[model samples]
Target: MGQRTTVATTFGSAVRESVGSSLAAVDAELARRYPGDAGTRQPVHTVYVPADVFTAGTVREWGDRALAALDEHAPDAEAFAAVLGLPGELAGPVHERVRAKLEREPVEDLRIDFEDGYGPRPDAEEDAAAARAARLVAEAYADGTAAPYMGVRVKCMEAAVRDRGIRTLDVFLTGLMEAGGLPGGLVLTLPKVSYPEQVVAMARLAGEFETAHGLAEGRIRFEIQIETTQAILGADGRATVARLIDAGAGRVTGLHYGTFDYSAACGVGAAHQAPDHPVADHAKAVMQVAAAGTGVRLSDGSTNVLPVGTTARVHEAWRLHHGLVRRSLARAYYQGWDMHPGHLPTRYAAVYAYYREGLERAAARLVAYTERAGGDVLDEPATARALSGHLLRGLDCGAVGTAEVTGLTGLDRAALERLAGRPAGRGF
Candidate 1:
C-alpha cells in the first residue's frame, strides 16, 4: 500500500484570485465572439427569385421544373451519377434522395431579391412588390408550403439607393407584421456590405423595427453579403470581415458571398469569373476564417451558367454546377445559391452524393471514438465532434436516413446531438 502524501504547490488560489477579473473579461469576450453553432438546421442552398416574379406557386413550380429537367436529361440513378462522377455505391441512394428531396422540399431557403435580381424599379412599383412579397410569403407559410427559411435581399447601403432600400425594407417588414406578425422563418439580407458601420446601421435599423412593432430587442437578424474588395481587406489592411461580425451586434446570421459582384470588383474578367476562381476562393477563405467560431454560417455564391437549351447543353451545365458544388462541399461550405430551377437538380445531386458517400465511414469513426474502442485510426474529441456534425447535417438535409445513422453509430438522434455539443432538445 502506498502512503498518501500532501502535495506541495508553488502557486495556489491567490494567483487565480489576483487575475480573476481579467479572466472574467476574457471569458465574456470569448463568449461574445464565438458563441458556437445555433443548433439549428442550416439549409443546403438558398434560391433567389425576383420579387416581381414570386408567387404562391413559385416553390411548387420550381420543384416541378427541376423534376422535369431530371426526367428529360438524367432519368436514372446510373445516368445522373455518371454525369456527376459519383461513386458506384452512392449512385442509387443519392439519386433516390435527390428525387425525394426535390419533391418533398425543393427549396430549403428562398430569398425574394430586390437587388440585382429585381434591379431598380419605380419607387411605387418597388414598394408594391415588396408588400406583395410579404403577403404571398406569409400566405405560403400559413398554408405550410413555404420553405424552411425565407427572406428578402434589399439593396446596399450605398448612397445611390440607400433611402430606397430602407423604404422597401420597411414596407416589406410592416406588411409581414400586418399579415399576422412575423413568421418564424423570416430572414433579411443586407447586400454589398463594404463597411462595418453599414452593419452597425443595419443592427440599429432592426432595433428600431423591433421597437416600432413592440417585439423583443434583437429579434430582427440578417445576413451580410460579402461582395466588395473592401469587405475582405480594408483601407487599413485589416481583415474587414471580422469587424463586420462584431458590428452586427449579434444580429448577423450569416455572411453570403456574392459571386459576380465580388469577382468583377477584383478586376477579374467576366468570362473568367466563377466560384472556383482563385480570387473568389481567397475572399471566401477569409470569410470562412472570420466566421469560423462566430456562430455565423458561410454561403457560397451562385453561378450564372444556366442549364437551358438542348439536352446535351443541359448535361454540360449540370456537370459544371455539380463539380463546383462538390468543390465547395469539400472546402466545408455547405450552402450556396441556386439561380434557376434547373440548377436545383444538380444542387441536390451534389449535396446528396457528398454526404452519402462519406456517411458510413464517418459513422464508424464516430462510434469507435464514442465507445472508446480501439480502431485502426484514433480520433480525438474534436474529430468526433466533426463526425457528429457531418451526420447531423446529412440528416438535416435528408441525404441520410435517421434509421441508417442509428444503425451504424448505435446512437440515436439525441445522443448524436449531445456528442456534437448542441444543446439537448434542439432537434435538427
Candidate 2:
C-alpha cells in the first residue's frame, strides 16, 4: 500500500498537467523521440482500495480487526467475509436505487470488497445489501471514464462464505453489466485463496457466467488476495499459487498481498503492525516471482494508515509520508493501492518522479555516448553494446519512450507492444 513509484522534484506541477490534459497523448509524444520507444500503456501509476475501506472514509473506528493475525499467519479471508455475513440477491427495486446512487458519484476506481464474512443479520437484507453494493459499484463505474478499474470481492470458499459467493456473483454481475458493462478488464478479487482448487471452482463459475451472458470467452480474470498463514507456508504455499494459475488457465491477471488478514492467520498483532513483517514479506516476494511476466500484475497490499490531520501542512505531510511508503514499495516492482480519489496524485507522482529522474540522466548520458562514438547516430559499435542494456533498463526506468527504444534497438511493433505493459518515465 505504501509502495511508491519513482518520484520527481516537479511532481506538483506534473500532477497539475496530468489531470488537466490528455496524459496519454502527451506521454506518447515524449516517448516518440527518446533513445527508445515510450509505448507503455498500463498506468505507470494507480491507486487501489477494497470496498469496505471506502465505507470507512478516513475514520479509524472502521479499522481492520485482524491486524496482528494477518501479519503472523495468512488466513482465509472469505471466512472473514462469511463472518461478516455479506451475500445473497437484493430485491429487484432496491437494487436499482443503489446502482443509480453509485453511478452519479465522481468516483473512478473502486473495489467492491467484502470486508468480513462475519456479522449480524443472516437474511435477505444482507443479500440485498450485497446486491445493492454491487449495483452501486457498477453505477460508480459507469459514470467514470472507460479506464476506471473495477473489481468484485466475493465471499471466501469456507463453508460460511462459499454459499454466498455464487449468490453474490449472480446478483451483482447482472447489475454491473447493465450499469456500464464490466470494466476494461473485470477483476474478481478472491479471498482466502488457499489452493488452486478454489481458483478452479471460481473459473468454472466464470465459465458459466460467460456462457450465460454470451460474453466473449476469457474476458474475466482473477486477482488473488493471500490471507491465511496456512495458505502461505512451505511447499503448500508455492503449490497453491501455481495451482491457482493453472485453475484460472490464463485468467488470473494479478496477485495482491492481503496484509491484515494474512497477519491475523499467522498470529501477528495489530492492524497497524508493519505489513512487510518478515514472513509476509517473504510470501509476497514468492508470489511475485511466481507471477512475474505471466502478464499477471503483482501488487503490494494497502497501507492501513488513514491520511488525516487538520491543516493543509498536515495533509501534505500525509501525502509525503505515503509518497515515501508507496515509493518504497514501487522500488520492489509492485504497484500499490490508493483508498481514495485524493490518493491518485500520490500514485502518479511517485511513478513519474521515479522514471523522470532516472530517464533524464540516462537520456543525457545516452546522447553523450552517441556523440563520443564520433557519430550523430545510435549504431556505432561501442555505443551499441553500452547502450543495449541501458536502453532496456532506461525503458524500465521510464527514461525513454517506445519510439526511442525502437529507434535505437530497431525492435519491431511486436516488441514495442510488449513494452506497453511496462511504464515509461519522460517526467513530462
Candidate 3:
C-alpha cells in the first residue's frame, strides 16, 4: 500500500492543516492551562458489555463471578455494594430472590446472542440479541433516557457475507437512538482497520446516520482497534497515524491495542507467555509513539492474566499490572481496558497515582523557579530547561497545563510572570 492514499476530501488542506495546527497548539495550551498531560485518552475508563449479559439464564454463576471480580478490582465497588451488602447495606427481605431475578434477566451482552426471531450479530438471531442488549442498556441508563459511552464492535464488513452484520448494527443502533437510546457517547468500534479508506467509509456512514437521526450531536465517533500485524508493522508508524487522523470521521475517539490478534500476527510462540516480552513491549512502544502527537487516544490491550481470587490477588498482580501500566503511562499512553472490572482500581490507581505525583513534583519545581525568572522570553537557557522539565511532566500527566500547576501549588499569576522572566529588563 502507498504511504499516502489519493483520497479526495471536501475539506481543504489549508483549512484542515490550519485546523490541525490550531488543534495542536490548543492541546499545548490545554496542557499549560489544565494539566501537563500529553497522553493518549481512550474515552475514560469503562467496561466491555459481554454477549452473555443479554441472554436469559441462570446468570447466578456469571453474576457471582462478576461480583467476585468486582470485590477485588472495581474501584467503585462501594457504589454497587448493595450487591455485596456492606455495612448499613440494605438488600431487603428478599434480597437474594431479587438479586436472582435481576441476574436471571437478560442484559446487553456483546459476546452472546439475544432474543428475536434472530439474534444480536450473526444475522436474525444476532440482531434480536443485540436489540435486547440495547433495550437493557436503555433501562440501565434510565429507560433509554441516556446511554453511557457505549460502542459496539460489530462484525466488520470484510467478507461479502458480513455486510449484513454491519448493516444490522446500523439499523439496530439507529432504532435505538431514535427511541432516545443515548448514553454518554455512542461509538462504533471497528475491529481491524487495515487502511485509511476503511475509516473514511465508516465516517461517511456515521455522517449519514447522524444526519438522518438528527442526533443532537451530529457526529458518529469511532474507536479503531489495531489488531493485525499489518497495522503495527512498518517503522513508518507516524505516516499511518497521520492518515487515520486525516480520515477520521467526525469522531475518532481512540486507537486500541489488540493483544491476542496482534500476537497472532507477530507469530509469537505462546499467546500469554510474556506480555512484556521484548516483542510485545516494542509493538506497544510503536503504538504509543504513533499516538503521541495525534489527537486520537490510545488504549493498551487488556492484561489477560486475571487474578485468581479476591484476597489480595489484585495486589499481587499489581506489581505486573502497575509495571505495564506505568510504562505505558510514562510513555504518554492513557486509557487501558479492564477486562475484569476488578482491575479498574489498578488502572485508576496507576494512572491517578502517576499523574498525582508527577504533577506535584513538576509543580513544585516550576513554582520554585518562578520566584526568580521575572518574565523573560521563555527562551532563556534557564527558562528553556524549566519549560522542558515542565513539558516532560506534562507528557506524563497527559496534559501540559503549567498554569494548572499554579493552582495546585498555590502559586499566583505574579509567580508565573516572574518565572516567565519579564522581557529581560523592560524595567523591573
Q: Rank the candidates by lDDT, best first.
A: 1, 3, 2
- TM-scores of the candidates are 0.98, 0.60, 0.61
lDDT of 2 at 60: 18
Q: After superposition, which runs of candidate 3 have C-alpha atoms over 4 Å from their true positions?
A: 1-44, 54-122, 143-148, 215-218, 234-239, 271-275, 310-315, 366-407, 411-428
Sorted on TM-score, highest at the top, how do the candidates line up?
Answer: 1, 3, 2
Predict model 3's lDDT versus the native.
0.52
Query: How many angstroms is residue 176 displaced in model 2 relative to the true structure, after the best TM-score fit?
Result: 3.2
Please name the candidate that would achieve the greatest TM-score relative to the true structure.
1
Q: Decide which is better by lDDT, 1 or 3.
A: 1
Query: What digit string (tens of lDDT, one per residue) describes model 2 on residues 1-428?
Result: 89888866755877887676867776654443222322332323233444334432311111222122221222233332222221222122222322222233223334656545333346575577666766655654455432235566777777766877777777777767667676563556777887667888888888888898888898777777777654555353344554565567767766777777887677778854445577667777777666644556666665555544443433453455345444444545435555544333234334433443344344444545545543344454444433443445434434346686566445643443333322333211
Q: Please write out the lDDT profile of model 1 over residues 1-428, one tens digit for every residue.
A: 59898999888798878788669989899998999888788999999999989999999999999999999999999999898888899889888988998899999999999999899999999999999999998999899999999989998899999999999999999999999989988989999999999999899999999998999998899999999999999999899999999999999999999999999999999998999999999999999999998989999998999999999999899999999999999999999999989999899989888888888889889988988886999998888878998999999999888999999999998898888887766654
The window of 10 residues in a row where model 1 has the poorest summed lDDT is 419-428
RMSD (CA, angstroms), candidate 1:
1.3
Which parts of model 1 have CA positions greater than 4 angstroms off?
1-5
